[model samples]
Target: MHWISMIGIALAANLDNLGIGVSFGARSTRVPFISNLVIAILSMIAAYLSITLGMVISQYVPSNYANWGGGALIILIGIYAVISDYKSNSKIQNENGITSYIHSPNKADKDNNKVISWKESLTLGVALALNCVVGGFGAGVTGLSPIMTTLFIGLFSLLTVDIGVRAGQQIAKTLIGKWFNLLGGVLLICIGLYEMFV
Candidate 1:
């Protein structure tokens, strides 16, 4: 039962990753397989860092307070996600003076041409990892065994996120486009609230 609960928590925490993956997929149609793998690896590293940090901090703070703190942080992240979703939903012209739909299939291809250099990929990887770390802190505060829990959660989360990205890429091939970021942002906010308050 305990293991099940841990896996459940890990799965819930991966919602953000799934959303981010979808956004990445929707934005880049030709995402290399290696790139996806790298993203997953970075996400795992982030989970590790977050869990380790949470464990260390747990020693300094009261358990109850730590839980509440985690909840508060999640709520804040939710609010930020909501705002970002709003901004991302707005229409914007690319450097080529083309007004692209957020859900457009060609948007990813167009964006891909903008030059996703290695430096950018590395930066995006770190960003993705940081996001995972934030959620991992909440998982750590739940009193689960850190390393074991992190491993299971990371693996599952990465798998789901990869699938989401691939699916988004495929779907982007059809319609004018979908607001995957907005959808993901909403999920994050909702999940964060649930974790914090419930």
Candidate 2:
């Protein structure tokens, strides 16, 4: 049960990192190990803090209400992700700096350096970590262990980014990269249901 939640949340949360990796690969940009590590650490820290917050909320609320509220929050996040991604597909919507970076990760590189340095990764990491904050809190309210979930998120973030970049053209050209947001949304919806019902 715990394993299911951990893995599901980890995979769902890191899909954006994978998409970022694909974008970088498409641009032939490299996220060096240190830079990737920096990103992963930020995500971990965000997840930890948000999860703690959710756990605190859970303490103040009835278990059933907590489950319903948290599950609804996760579902809403999933729906929002799906709708945002769909709109992104249908038209050229104007986005702010951080949002633009999320959709097109190449912008995060800034200096036109083929490599993402550790320093450059800080902002990018924060952008990525924001996605985890709410989701982590929702999962935390469902009683998933904060430490375990954070560890899983960090591991998956590291691995997904590396794998996406390494897979390069092959993955970029595939439907997976193109449909990443949808896949992530679907996964989150499932996890939300699990949290509420199981």
Candidate 3:
């Protein structure tokens, strides 16, 4: 429940938002305000749930084990993120004997007409929020305040996405295209590893 812990958890949880924002912003796509709000809300809910789950588990398990478990869970989530992103980025062969790939939210926005619809925003929000759940659970197990964590996460996510989008708009594509998710995943894994040992 320390303020420092809350801040750390929030920042670690939402780093991916910057990447998402940059991806969309680089294409001049606006993530509508409502969508941003929805994303915050969704992130809050997911974080709260994960923390609550941790608290419940804490009641049944020793505090030490709970901490280790939470840390392990977060590490697993980080690995999943990296693997999933790698899979998504790889080309797939379709029935037409052509290679294709899943679209990034920004690319989808562009394909759908250079504007990101509310629904699309919600979908993006959900996807982004997934990154927060594991870290939130770990923070909760280590005695962080779920409410404060959620509040910080929502606020940080909103701000990060906004900043990322703005930065994306200014940055070159070659730079932006590089490795946002990979970096975020590595950060999460490192944080989880730190938590596990400490």
Candidate 4:
């Protein structure tokens, strides 16, 4: 059961990486191995920090309350992601660092270098990691292992980005492709519900 929850959280966290990877791929932008590694490392660290905070919160709150509360927060975030993507509100989304990058992955390739350097990757890493911070807390509250989840999140992030880039514009062009991250959102909802009941 913990394994299920662990896998679910990892998968949910990295789906956006795949979409962003596809965005990079579509524009011929490159996410070098080092840059990708940097992103993964940052994501892992962020997840760990948030999960620890959640564990702390879990300690102070009743198990049921913590479970329900964390699950509810994750569900709300998931729903927001789905609705925001569906609505495509430029004014608001444009101001969002990550959302804007999701729309134009090439922006990460500053200097028009086509390749994302490890140095340039810092911002990307932070932006991507922020997406999973809240969910990391939720999973931690539900008793997921911080180490395992962090490791899985990092592995999945690295793989998804690499594969998505390899799959390239083809993946981004598919009908369902546009909603890829939204699928992750749905998975978050399912994970939240699972944490609540099981």
Candidate 5:
């Protein structure tokens, strides 16, 4: 029962990663495999760090306070997501006095493209990993052992996110539509608040 609950918690926490991956994949026809791999690696590292920090902090803080802190962090992330989505939707008038919709490339064009730079991959990896940690910390405060829970959460989250990215890449060329990242953001905020206060 404990393991089942832990896995469920991990899955719920990773929904943000899935949503982010979908957004990224929706914006790019080609899923950068190397970038995804880097994301996975960085997520593992962040999960490790978050779990370690949580363990140490749990010793000093009341359990309820720790949970609330985690919940607050998640809420902040949710707000950021909503803001980012809105910004992405805003129209920008180019210096050429023209406005164009941002569109992803076709699959054929992407297949012939060069690999993304390591530096770019690293930056994306770090950002995605940080997101994982914030979500992971919130889920971890439920008394599960951090190390094992972090490992499972990181691994499974990466797997699910990669799947979403790949699927998005395949259809991105044909799916030139806007996604409401704000929906996920709102969901995150509600979940975080419920966890903290309920």
Candidate 6:
């Protein structure tokens, strides 16, 4: 993948991290620097593996089909994100809960002290990184370098989360967290469509 495309994929892959970060920030939860580092590293690994798998899969199919297939996968992932976000929001409404565990790394408790544990940080990192694997596959099929993609993923994951947390701190009460995922899904779907058509 070209450097520009790698950056795009990385941004899309970690967009959810912004929302997750917002959730953490709104609660005044501290995300340790180490946690950010771990998340970045895990995402890089996931990107490498997914892209390699896509490369392997590309070998078996007609080049045209492979391209469309990659696009289709991205669209499907976007659709899934949109659906999941809607369902999660609805469920939270029904439960009358202040905290949502769906599609987020932050956990809500009755106690005001809401620091995220290191274990939870690792788990969250893994969960968030899973989103990138399929995207890396899409990029891989389109001929992106795994090494460059990994670097982009690591960089974007850290940047997006940091920004999201800060922004969340400013608008935590007013912002609806699900919209972050919703926007990310829309971008993914658009990228997928663009890949298929272009």
Pick by TM-score: which candidate is best? 2
lDDT of 4 by residue, 82-136 (tens): 8876776444454555646656667778899889899878888888898779989
Candidate that scores best on lDDT: 2
Steric collisions counted per model = 4, 0, 0, 0, 0, 3
**How displaced is residue 13 in candidate 4, in Å?**
1.2
Query: Global CA lDDT of candidate 5, please?
Result: 0.57
| Candidate 2 residue-wise lDDT, 30-100, digit = tens | 99999999999999999999999999989999987888788888888898889977988899867677656
User: Would you give me the overall lDDT of model 3?
Assistant: 0.72
Indicate whether candidate 2 or candidate 4 has the larger lDDT.
2
Runs of candidate 1 with Cα error greater than 4 angstroms are 1-34, 91-123, 142-145, 173-179, 182-198
Clashes of 1: 4
lDDT of 3 at 116: 68
Which lDDT tens digits does candidate 3 get at residues 24-88?
77777787778788888888999999988877777888877876776777677678768866876
Once fitted onto the true fold, the runs of candidate 2 whose alpha carbons sit more than 4 angstroms away are none
Which portions of model 6 miss their true places by more than 4 Å? Answer: 1-4, 93-104, 108-120
lDDT of 6 by residue, 121-184 (tens): 6667777778788888987776668888889899999997788778786757775665777877
lDDT of 6: 0.76
lDDT minimum window of 10 residues, candidate 3: 93-102
lDDT of each: 0.57, 0.88, 0.72, 0.83, 0.57, 0.76
Instruction: Rate residue 21 of model 6 by lDDT.
Output: 83
Candidates 4 and 6, the one with greater lDDT: 4
| True-structure RMSD for candidate 4 | 1.9
lDDT agreement of model 4 with the native: 0.83
The TM-score, computed over Cα atoms with residue i paired to residue i, of candidate 4 is: 0.92
Better of 5 and 6 by lDDT: 6
Clashing pairs in 2: none
**Per-model TM-score on C-alpha atoms:** 0.62, 0.95, 0.78, 0.92, 0.60, 0.83
